[model samples]
Target chain A: MSVAQISRNEAQAPVEQREALPLRIVRRLANSRELTLFVLVVALALAMTIVYPHNFPTGPNMRAVLLNLAPVGILVCGMMLLMIAGTFDLSVGSTLALSGVWAGVVSGWWGWPAEAALLIGVVVGAVAGLINGLIVTRIGINALIATLGTLTIYRSLTYVTAGTGVTPISDSFAEYGRAADPVLRIQSPFWAMLVLVLIGGWLIARTRFFRQFYFVGGNPRAAQLSGIRVDRLILIGFVIMGALAGIAGVLGAARLNSAVVNAGVGIELKVITATVLGGASLKGGEGTVLGGILGVLFIALIENAMIINAVGVFWQGLVVGLVLLFAVSLDRFKTAGRA
Target chain B: MGSMLKSTLIALGMTALASAVTAPARAQESSFGPADAKETYYWISNKANLPLFVQYDYVGMKKIAEELGVKATGGRQVAVVGGWDPSLTESVKKCIEQGVPTVVDDGDLPASGRLAYIGTNWTQVGVAQAKKMMEKVPNGGKLAMMSIINAGNMREAVAGFKAYIEANGGGKYNIVSNEDDGGDAQKAAQVTAAILAANPDIAGIAGFDSESGAGIVTALREAGKNPGDIKVTAMEQTPDFFKTAKEGWVDGIVVQNRELFIYYAVKILHDYNHNGLKSAGLAAADGGRPVPDTLDTGVLLVTKDNVDKVTAALGVK
Candidate 1:
């Protein structure tokens, strides 16, 4: 791995390439999709508040929205990084099943400690991601194609191992997953997700190895000429995604107190939708962890609002699809001149 | 000598032709008998991804296989074409390749060459659910339904529901909305919530899939309505569904008799394989006899009266 040669510069860029004064303004204007999304999200929240007057902005509803965002929230973190690195991992939803069911086996059946089981689940997720990376990089498969195949394979494997039902585990396991402190006014996993987003977002924005990821995604030939190990960086992105998805699966199992079969089903679609809605480019080379998550929150808010307001759940895809199309179109418009 | 040999050959050819003409009668008898080779039976479902329901049917079939000292293992087909229709064909091909006497669930394999089909008559299930809904909401009112809308299983159930409602309620009852939840819990919750929000006057909601029950209950809870405030007739029972039923959060559920469906299939295939069922007077859909093409496993409505029996029976909660 060329990772040993890569070091974190922490606060400074390795190369001193500065944007010209007027160009900076144009650059910001061209990439104002996130800025527009941020405004839309704020406006949506306000509109929801106006409609409900009482329930929309309540603490309990906020908790629900955050909890709903937790699984996909973690996913958007990895996806943003991966997307920024110019690849994708669609197998996360299926890997979630595999990771959760396997942990249920180790912890509940094999009588391992919950912590150890959780660790093992995360490791398995990492391995699944590693395999995905290898297929895409080493075997010369496209990222989308590799992950799409694994998605079905992993989900089927979960069914083969855990069967097609919820495998209930110990009560203690559920505690870790669903525990809510009355004082905090939120669940344990909600706080954990907040911490993950904070750290993950910081790393992407600040770290040297991660900064190189943008170049790899933006242009592989340029990145290769610049001495960046594009494949390894992409592989790390997958591992991060897999690990986060694993955590989400284990948490889901714990919350249900059962190993759920289809817990993460269709989540990849949601994560991608939210990511794109949050302003990540499908062509790669751009996105932020916080921005992607805001998009997640926006979608989650809409879903919660739908249920809260009596909107048709079937319309979620239509709404998200339209929003995504709008966001991507705006992104294209912004990048047109630069490209 | 050549003329004598030619005559003999012609006589042998005549004898072969006579047998060929009468072969259908003999072929029928042996066809009813067991195969000379010892092997296993196959049961693959198109709706195999639905683990809660699929696993139970497979286990029941597996139990029968154990009793007969045969083996069986199956999986779901990836919904590639026409949603779920392809699964049936794919499973049939697997069975054909294995050369096993196969019984398929979902029963809509077109012409995939299966011994027989065994599963809930989803239309009948809808009928039963509709019947239950009418019983609950005797005073006709607005109703809602939550399902994948286009799924084959849900398609029949939805049809039956609409048929029963239209037939029974006349113009008295109205279906407010039949929203698709896409088989996701969160989506179900959101859909249920929205449906309830718009139609606060909604008298009954037919929770047509396993996901719909909890979604409906949770939305009701979130909306500050008692689970019993709305008349809910769920189509399937899972562990969570049991909790909702017990808490009076779910009014009743139409439990598909999957065990009966799977076990009956095992018995039919085993009986066919072990002996000449035809010789034992098994009518081939003829002679005004008892031979039938499909078995409706039927559904049980688990309400307050039978909630205990159902929950204890399932041992889920």
Candidate 2:
């Protein structure tokens, strides 16, 4: 079966025989990766709430957790799109730093209007993405190698552009990130990520043009034979990925009001981890924007729990890695159930 | 043919006389100038990208290089020894054996037989921070500290801070939280916000890492806490720190002599090369102006009262 069909089959349960409710629930969880991640995220959040009632469930703590995960959450939308198209960008972390620095230089150093800085920063990120797309499609370089090369190149450019960093990048520019709704009190980055996830989810699941990425990722050669313009689709996927990374980068810098050169260092791993857990296969064509976002939520909760528990930071990676492996291992049960 | 030979001989004679004439002046130039303009010296550190190293240490090295007429570059250079890893001590020893001049900074590695030790006395920095906190919160309440707790220097500083509080402050101070900010300002801010959430009664915060001060102040502003709501003593003397100090968020800053570390390390290296001290070997104990065992570049306490004066002197603003 094609990779696109693989994800679809999860929803169609076999009418073979009646089973115990517990077994049915287990089978249901195994079948849907989104359900599994959602359940897991809910469970983790509930458990933390129960255990550390005062600390974990408080308004300030929740706000901090939501705000902290915003960047990763925003990046996951683009990553899910790329992974659905059978490729990914490792340069996102560096892209974030580079974009933030440009924004800082424009608004903070050059004394441009905040809107101009925001526009320039996003444009820089899209241009960077455009370069990645051209290189991968035209040069036919592997996405891994192409993006990995750009990762260091972009980071080096960031340092060359602003050695230490641009701090206190105008209060007007900072307001874009710092502004929060009175109801939830969550910052702009979180709100931005939410809007992207909702829109991206609808477009990928419903729209004809976005659905073409599934065909391209599932089987590129077959997709091209069917007049899919596989390379064009993949290139578009990368550009979208880059633009999303740019938005994330700009928001992060604005929120902090400081464009740190090392902002989002090693964040690519976290983002990729969340994408994989969200149900994106390395071979592609098997994930949802919702799944990717749930993965981000799960990891954020895990980190928040660790922080609340006062666990050493060293244990965090171990916990997250083990959880990822455990989540992926659940796929084996789904395969067995299909048999 | 004989006339041509005479002309060559006369040219050779003039060149020889000129070299003889300039030799003493050349020797005198080499003697006075500490380093050769053609030779390049390097300022090496593990985290060269760190703001402390980038903004101050590297600048200091470059300034000294210009003065000494030598080119200086910040490179990976030999092995940089920091952290709590015991293996690093052996690595330093091995590098020392390979005739590499290693200098310890921020933290001491005396067993490694380094040429000289420069930078803040870590333990003293902690004591100074603690003392500053004591000054602000005389009847001390619960205190929280932020740093990279795993680092060797930070551990010493924390221990010293704790020891001083125990010995000096008659049971008034209690360390409620000592968390690691991981040296990233953003992470520091997040951690500080969480810390504030967890410890609503947190009386004061002592920030050991350079990033901690900004993080603490940012967290306070985000939480809508006014200046001096909770006493804060932080490290480093960055421009952000200066701004925060002016706003009265930070009670006192335990400022390390960052530039002085580079200044003294390069001086030690220069003298080691040009002052005929190369033969002094690993310990440099052969007695020809033996390398200073340790140069505690020391710390400066910058409070709101003297922040303007300090910033003016450092030309930070």
Candidate 3:
């Protein structure tokens, strides 16, 4: 080898080796959406804890915040899945109301068993989802149009089925939602959300069957040519989303012991916001369940802090929207830096 | 023979035409004659999905429709149930201009040229709520009021509540926060918890919407507080309110005369349609007759003692 080439190699080797380990770790964290969200969530919690030690970090406040964010967190798992597969459901809020109303009717009015009520609620949600899936997969309608149409239709059905909603929906059924852990004293809804997030994260990150969704979302034509059942996977994704909404609905109704006809109103936007903030893109195939849940946690903390500080309700939405834009913009910088 | 048949047919047609023209005139001659099927008395309202409307307004409309023998149509808009929106005021003005008798419900727009408003006097309702709170906590203490505060009627209610407390509370009652719950039960519960956490010395809570009682009760229960730990007075007589009050989770409720509002509003509009301006002894101005400008539907205060009586009278059981 020539001395000139040798000298060039020696210089390049030194430059590469001189890059510090800490700088590399920082770059890796920046590149990872989930890690960045985790850090932000921890940082926010620590800040609130230090600033409002008496109110923000108290047991009752923590429990309330967790319980309140449970429904949105549960919905995020399904939304993350759909977003990863390049499709989404706008009818989740309506589906939740419909499911909850049915549960109320069965247990409160019809004298059905609590278990049957729960099962029926979930089944109704699944059926609603099946219709959405069939419309999109079989009829070839866009996911947005199909879900938006069903959103109104399902809400109307809920109103038709029970106009004023059912109150005092049986004490036995309410226990399912009211049950809490002894240590944390957090409600069942929060626990349900935690379990779902863990299982969803594992399945999407490690399982080969679920990984096919990433391929389908990335390139549908290529995925189809590769013998993947793109339509079937998308359909399954919707069913799962529907069932999660059902679970959330029943749990919420049980917690309040009332099946409100307007339950879950305008929740679709919040779920989508968290999902996008968690790293899921409209283009799809890029987010994990962990990132999505962390996004929910961060938003929930911000809201809790605002409430603790006695901020006006009008300002909460603006703050959340700005945070979402800022988080998404960070990705652009990270990508540019990588290039 | 054909000409004779044609002449007979023409005579019959002329008789039918004359009868048709005279029928309405004869009907108009009576003070309150039977209503024709085509004369529809529309009750225009907003937020038709509210449980109050579902339970009372629609049911009352059905009864009035059957009695009056006229098609009772309720034109409902899903948006803007409260506050004074220019659009709603304009709509009422246009109705008056078009010679449509419009009576507002739930919230009133006085400048809209509406014939009448058959709903609670929001300020008075607030005063009533304050009285109930005072009764429960006679000495008074720190309090929190929750409602959709941006709404015009709600603002009036809050103002009335504060005024009553200030005037009659002997300076004992203190309201620390007036939180907006967005008229949602779940959001109400969340805000209630936050309020409780922030102000531990809170002695009472006043809810000024239908969804408030359930939310307040749920929040209290979740916080592990017992019945009567914090006095609560809410508006509306919903089934959930009945259940919570019966269980001693709620102290008192100020229920508006909602059914009466619907029942009387429909009857008044029906009477106007049949009787016209002359029968009511009123002059028509701007193509609209002056009827009752504001009808105070009034309210009923329901404690645990009187809840059963009120709910029973309303046929809630």
Highest-scoring model, lDDT = 3
Candidate 3 stretches greater than 4 Å from native: A1-30, B1-36, B44-46, B76-87, B278-282, B285-288, B313-317
TM-score of every model versus the real structure: 0.75, 0.86, 0.87
* Residue-wise C-alpha lDDT for candidate 1, range A1-339, written one tens digit per residue: 355444544223534346677766655754765666677778888998888766677655566667667888888999999998888899999888778877777777668888887887787688778777766765667988989988986776666555654455677776777677767556666777888899998998899878887898899889998899888888888888889888888887776566766768888988998887776778889888888888888777777666656555466557767777777676776767567
RMSD of each: 15.5, 12.0, 11.1
The DockQ for candidate 1, computed on C-alphas, is 0.11
Find the candidate with the highest TM-score and give its number: 3
List of chain B TM-scores, one per candidate: 0.73, 0.80, 0.80
Candidate 2 local lDDT, A192-290, one digit each (tens): 999999999999999999999898889988889999988888888888887888888889889889887778788899899999999899998889999
* Winning model by DockQ: 3
Model 2, runs deviating above 4 Å: A1-20, B1-36, B76-91, B166-172, B277-289, B314-317
The candidate, 2 or 3, that scores higher on DockQ is 3
lDDT of 3 by residue, A121-190 (tens): 8887887787778778866789999999889877867776777778768998898889999998999989
- lDDT tens per residue, model 1, B184-291: 665566666556655667898887777777667655654567767888888564554676677877677887776566567656666655544353466422222222
| Cα lDDT, model 3, residue A190 | 93
